[model samples]
Target chain A: MKKILNSADTFVRDTMEGIEAAYGDRVGLLDGDFRVLVSRYPAPEGKVGIVTAGGSGHLPLFLGYVGQGMLDGCAVGEVFASPAAEKMADMIRACDRGAGVLCLYGNYNGDVFNFRMACEDVEFDDIETRQLLGRDDVASSPKDRADKRRGVAGLVYAFKIAGAAAERMMTLDEVTAVTARALDNIRTMGVALSPCIVPKVGQPTFTIEEGQIEIGMGIHGEAGIEVRPMMTADEIARLILETIEADMPLNAGDEVSVMINGLGGTPLEEQLIVYRSVHARLAERGVAVVMPHVGEFATSMEMAGLSVSVFKLDAELKELLRAPAATPFYTNANK
Target chain B: MKKILNSADTFVRDTMEGIEAAYGDRVGLLDGDFRVLVSRYPAPEGKVGIVTAGGSGHLPLFLGYVGQGMLDGCAVGEVFASPAAEKMADMIRACDRGAGVLCLYGNYNGDVFNFRMACEDVEFDDIETRQLLGRDDVASSPKDRADKRRGVAGLVYAFKIAGAAAERMMTLDEVTAVTARALDNIRTMGVALSPCIVPKVGQPTFTIEEGQIEIGMGIHGEAGIEVRPMMTADEIARLILETIEADMPLNAGDEVSVMINGLGGTPLEEQLIVYRSVHARLAERGVAVVMPHVGEFATSMEMAGLSVSVFKLDAELKELLRAPAATPFYTNANK
Candidate 1:
């Protein structure tokens, strides 16, 4: 329950100010908005300007992804809420290179609505744009079609491919094509072990029984599809992999990259335990894991569950994933 | 206190097995030790092998850092303990290139003894080796002579510069030079808000009052110098920065890379607040922050608190840092 803030309302703004202060020389804030652009006004001409925006609270996800290789800019909103339309517009305008901008974001209603609105606003300023809403959360949809599901940690992988393509000065259409490919290959599902308390609300976002878990909770504390008794690490991993496989329809001999992300409260040891179960289950099915990342890649505030994400990798996607990436949240250094 | 493990003694081995199972195609365990090497073994013949080893619990550190553009290999031991001399020797042998091998690690009695033993073993085998003991924790030493302090988060900067140099095919001596420069310029101080639990002990690593903090804590839950009542965000930032400034002898207008790393249990929002205080203080002094990262870099299980590290960037060090890096624990994508 402890926090360091003057008040809940100022948390997002103050935090953004800090981010700007830290990287101000390389990044700049749009006047009077949540938009942040990599400094120097516009990126090199002909490059597809990469922009990702979403609600705050997921550091490195919505904003921390902005830098040399990942996002060109990010529009941040208040905690768990979409940024205002004007903010998204300003962010796009700042990063636009005349080749056009690609609006990459999660598939939450508020984010979609605002980002779509911003698309119109930027178009009015004579800048062309394309919107690609990520729908990669397999747990939220049935087996036949997961594109209708929500998007969660899968955005990180998509960002990697899209960012790499954009950095190569790929056309907007090319960038979009690669991003969609990466998105289609990505599937994610998260469980909630404990609820997160919004700073403004000062209460639990959701509730679960002691020693129990919610199998398909959304990032904003939305209810899950099912509530299940507490299970062992292996059991949880099986349920998650089973659900994701059903939705994504991965078959034997598929090459995949796996991520077991902690939802804040879990320790690295415990996450590794989850990964152990996940890897064993995948091995039994003959799938080859090309890359495995075990840590807190994305997190909800103090939530204890872990989310599993699998990205079926192709030659191009594997190369992009192997491409170097550095951000505040993730480092490739041998520290 | 709940954990998913057959027993405490089995944790490290089990975890390594799981990592190999998941990433065996990309990474492999050294022939007979806990050291993990990026698959393809022995890197290029002339490529300097950057080897880092320490205790197991700090994931992404010893293991996560061993990948492309970073470490060639890492040796791991039980939780909070150094690898055995033979294991360290085996790790050096597995990773050594004709150029030489560099033994970079933390400064602790167990680590120093075992690493020295490793150096001797490697020399007996005719593989030249050098040691770069990281001692960047400023709180343990006064401003006049901080070289005696133990290493903390600052070791990350050293690793990055060294790893990047090695990736560029620098000779072992050259890599060692860059690493020494990084170590000289780097400084870190950590504060603990809560303590981690060691599985073997099945208890908290240290204790603190609900609202108190321990400044200058060692990574293994060792006691800190000051046990002050909790203060505002600004106060904590000032304390950390002042200690760093005094210890590093950094003057105004110095360009530095800063990292505010969470111990484990602290949330990102809290870390951002700490970042706010940190940036504001540095900005007031006109210090140029070249690179700023805020997140869980080097953790102590689920212990809460954060460490602040500043590395005064010089031309070569900055270039190496800007080099592309990609690992399981971090990434700095190529521009």
Candidate 2:
């Protein structure tokens, strides 16, 4: 991988420092560790503070969403590694506006364990807190245990809903309920054509033959369900949609929002090609697509592949999706 | 040079069809000639309909910025190739409201020539039109004629100012003046570690030896003024800043907005590292950064490099920069 850098170990911390310097006036870090970047002002009195924690590398994903109309604070983990429970607890305390705090993140094993423990510890401090886990990657689990799927790009949508609800001074339980609802309707599936390089390892996380693609690959380079010869755009789109439909069981008439995300190296043009095929097949299946976003919404550092995320939007989900929330990454037309 | 596709010629047109299919209900396209895309519903009646055009390949750069709070319409040329003058004239007429139309684009030679002809044709059609060029690439011209530099990512800023002013019901001339002012304040420089394959050619745009980079390279794979061995993030940041400073001459205590945009293949993590170095250098130089947008604002297919853009902000430019605008590519808090 060609890049401009000093060392892999310093990637996350240095990036966070730059983020602070650029937006520090609007945000602040925890007393010691800067990983727990938060708004300069804590949540208002009696408001539910929202804290999201996950491994770094996904920009505008966690920290980008931490701002006025979005997250109150976020705990940064190491690159694709979960932050410690103690640090997570501190972030919750710093942003807990009197009402309570909600800790939200993608459903990864290490993340799940650490954040849950942090919630309990924060509660022991007499600070009310709850955990909202996003399990939206249909490719990670079969139909019977779809809830066991990994969380992928759909976490962004959950952040939006939860962040907006919290910004409106919603109660902790309400924020959790809204975010859970958002996750319930969100389903994502990803394929990797190339592997991303871990800074420490200084090598690829996964590998494939020149023209091969692995569908249902995890972000941390976890093994995918199957490997197949590279397929046409139409074939790949069909494979992703078929898996998502079987896992989530979306009906023929369901209306959904589509996200055609690039895994870094795949150009936007290629993503749009996949989007065209996906849209055609969805139309053939009599599904209605609303508010589709075709771009690099979430990426895997220089990996060449694409993911398709479908969010089955109801009145509430659609309204939340349309609501204006400002994050460095995501934006909406309605405020 | 790896891509999954049948051919390159059909790429952009097919992608446009898909973009329309996703958002086409609200978007309209010119029937066959220019491939110009415009907004649907209540086309502006008495306002200056802003028309911007350029080659394809820069996903959100020239076209993605078109929508309600942004451009009225866009005419897309072939991939990395400028559109014909007659085609631009046709699109300008389709988008022209009774007030007049404004032609906005980069300052590349081909773009300048075609856009000038389009402007003349529109004037002959008894419709008033003005041309505003974005010449922000500092490395393209000598210090004395930085105004002749090719437009890079700074075009986004010009588009923002023009779109906001037009939305506020400004006259065509007023919009032109503000856009020119914003463009004048903007300066950009880029580096290239590798090159992207032109779809038809199926080869890299340029070749670089291992462990080497081209500083001040153009977005379309044009050669840089300085060719140096690959350096650390600090060294690269310094090279880019020095080039921009030498060209635009930003002084200490100047307030500017920074955009660290990845060319294509560079990861967001690496981009942030570059940002870290850039922030430190700017702070050391006593410059106050107003807004720092760090991501892929403009890209060259799958090249591994980034560009730094600094737009010196006045009160009006800052207000416009902060104003709410929503397009496929960008969105602010209020949108």
Candidate 3:
């Protein structure tokens, strides 16, 4: 594979080393388990600790959120592979400050099974915990089966809101409630124009003819809903917005936050254009946008395309999203 | 070409629309001139205002730096084409306060010609202005011929340091002096693995054989120092670090900042891996890295590769680098 790495076998470890080297003041690996990354400064006494974990290849996703106003720790896995249950348990135990912990992550089968094992593994710690999975990808499943949906860019909202609640000294039950509410308000859809190769696989995860697009593709190159000829930026933005609205309808006078996340290879300019369209469409619907994010919040390792996420908001959600946060890849100081 | 644009004709303006839509609260298009973007909250009275201009396609370049505590205004151009002198004059006039304005941008032929014309055009306005060019690419020219070097990722440093000097209310001459010092102490180099397709051009800027790399290539696909087979991330990092050291030696006990900038399509995971290597190599020589950045700061559109920039800093320079600055795409809340 034409990837800039020393070796495929050590890809994840090498990436983690670089991340720790660059952001040591902010985050580092847990002492007992190298796969678990914890914030340098733990939460205050009696404050619930927020933790997350997921596969690799998506920067700013699993570990990039660990910091002052965000996640407390995270368990990292190999590229697109789930981490072990013991690592998750180690993260939970380390982050527990006698205020319990929250196991937040995506809705992948591998991740779901491991998180279950992790909760049982930490039962003796006497620290109550809650499991909240981000199931915001509306295109993955119908409205009646939202639990089966794959979490995508909207997972970022879950991290921000949940972390803000915990940082504000919310109890474990309160933090879980707000996180679940935030997750329920999020709806996301994506379009992919090209495939990305896994360094170890040395091949494209999937293929499409040049000048075509895949609708509703999973981050790990799972089959999208359909393959069709490429559409203009505005067309793609409108289609994604329409689909999201169909599922989580944003009516007149409603307010929300919008995110146009790039799937790695897309340029920031293009993502902004997509954001412009999304905002314009929302404005036409009389919906106000509070804190909008347009960049590569989550990516599929150089895959070409973008995802649009809208989080319907209330006063509390707005304040939580705007809470001061400082992480290596993300910083929202507009408190 | 596979791009998410509405049309190649309106690429620049459409992108500008998106940018203004997203960051309208922080920046807006200059009245009576759509090509010039000025900060919403201009610099305080009597503070030196900073303005920069260059061709488009490089997001977070000229326009992305225009906001609070950064550039006061910027003139936007068509993709890879220099903006007209009158537009630059408009930006200069809009940003100029009672004190003066600083014209800091890359040392490009068209940009140099236009900035000169722009200053002369606004001379009748009776507002004093100073010109500073960024020339940090060591691959384009040797140290003795540094003036002939092309600006690349190091231009971001110029914007940040110079903007910080201006924001802190330094005198026009003083800001110019510190900016010149920062430019003198900086060095940058890059390698492009594949070509980027310009929107209107409808073709690759330059072509390379598969799995090959163009060492020291320019952002606009300009020919590099040489072409060779792709090397491992560690080898590439060492080669670049050694080359930079050969020209500007970094001895023991040296303190500086490092940046591993992705060229557009490269994954963040890969960039972090490269950062890991660069940091390890620097540490081997007893150099201390502060405020290391690993992401897409300045980029060529959809190009596959990355650039490394090192800013050798003194006490004052380090403080300025750590100063708080916030733009739409770049935010340094760390002070």
Candidate 4:
């Protein structure tokens, strides 16, 4: 593999060690447990604690989001493998203050199952917690089975909005309610130009014909929902937006935040190019984009693709999304 | 080439369109001249106007820094090709606010020649202007010939320090003095794992064996000063830090801001892994790291490698580096 790493066995641990070394003032491991990361600045007592956990490889997602005005703690897993339930329980306990903790994570079989077990364990300790699943990717399932869909880049909006709500000292139930609302309003779809090699696998996850593009491919390179000849940036933007609008029914005067998230290998230049078409298409439909995020907010390790997430916002959601966020990997001006 | 673009001829234009569409609030083109990007909130009458220009393909480099507290304007060129002197002159005239303008750009042959001509053209218009070149690539030249060295990732520090000075309403001479001090204290080196395909070229810039790497490779795949078998991330970090220290002489009590910038295709996970070693080595030497930036701050489109920039700072540079700055691609919390 043409990757800059020491060994496949220690890829995840090495990454965590590096993360702590770089952002020690803002984030650190929980009691020297490298798998559990918590913010260095703890929230006030009675403030709801937000926690997210998932497999590694997706930086700025489960792990990079833990800091001031964002997630309180994150239980990190190995590459594409869920963390242990005990680790998740430990993270929850660390982030828990007088207010209850919220288990906010992506909706995946491994993650959901482990988090369910974690909540059960934490329940025995009498730490109140609420579970909120991020189900925003429209390609994994039909709208009728939305709850079964997998989460992708849209998970960023969940962390952002929910973290902002918790930072504002909302109750656990209130934070969960708003986060669920965000999940319900968010939709994300990805187009993969190339496959990525997992550290452990040491080979391409999948192969496709050269110059072909796969729409709605999972981050892990699972079979795409639609594979076709490579389309122009405008065409790709249209296909993704139409699919989302059909499911969410965005209309004139609708205000939303748009994120063009590079998976891993794509450059910010291309993400902005895609965002141009996305913004133009939305402008044509009279939909206003408030906060435009274009970069690698979430990524699969060295995967060449980009995902677009549209989170339709109301007044309250808009305010929360605009609230200042200061994480090691992300920071906002609070404008 | 496997790129999400409309046409190769319009690659730069397409990127500009996308950037302006997404960040119109923070940056825009001058009049109908798309090559000249100026900040939306122009500098006040007496504030020094900071303008940077260079060939494209480096996101957040010459273009992304044009905004409040960073750059007043930038004249953009094609991918790896310098912009015309007329466009540079136009950018200078547009940013001039009675108080002089400072032209801050990299030290490249085509750019130096072009900016020299640009200043001459503006001199006739009676618009006061001064020029400062960023030269920090230790690999490009020896300390005895540092003036001939090429500028690379260390250019980011120049912009950050210079932009902060201009925003504080420093005079042209004052801004020039502080920026020159920053340039003298900076050093950079890069290691390339793979090459990137220029959109118009439709081919990789260069190639290497499957398990080989090139140290000190330029962003456009220029011949490296050193090539060897692939090394672990720790080894790579040591090689780079050793080279930079040889040139800059970092001391035990020195305080520096480190930037491990990914060249498009390197994932943040690997970047952090490298940072882990970089931080450990610095700590061992008793050199303090402040405001570490680890990401794709500057990139070659889809190039799989990274560059390390260490800018030793004093009290003044440290405050300026930490000052609040907001651009489309960057922002600081003003902490």
lDDT of 3 by residue, A13-44 (tens): 88999988998887898884558899986678
What's the residue-level lDDT of A1 in candidate 4?
Answer: 82
User: What is the Å distance of residue B160 in model 4 from its true position?
Assistant: 0.7
Better of 2 and 4 by lDDT: 4
Each candidate's DockQ = 0.31, 0.54, 0.69, 0.68
Tens digits of per-residue lDDT for model 4 on A58-80? 88777988888889999978899
- Give the Cα RMSD of candidate 1: 3.9
How does chain B score by TM in each prediction? 0.94, 0.94, 0.98, 0.98
lDDT of 2 by residue, B279-303 (tens): 8899898898887888778889888
Tens-place lDDT per residue, model 3, B110-204, is: 99999999999888999899999888888998878988998888988888898899888999999999999998888999988878888998888
Please give, as one word, the docking class of candidate 2: medium
* Model 2 chain A: lowest-lDDT 10 consecutive positions: A326-335
**Each model's RMSD to truth, in Å?**
3.9, 2.5, 1.2, 1.2
Error of 2 at B103 (Å): 1.7
**Looking at candidate 1, what is the lDDT of residue A186?**
87
Model 3: residues >4 Å from true position, as ranges?
none
Query: Each candidate's fnat, in order?
Result: 0.38, 0.57, 0.66, 0.68
C-alpha TM-score for every candidate:
0.86, 0.93, 0.98, 0.98
For model 2, the stretches where C-alpha displacement exceeds 4 angstroms are: A40-42, A168-170, B4-7, B32-34, B41-44, B144-148
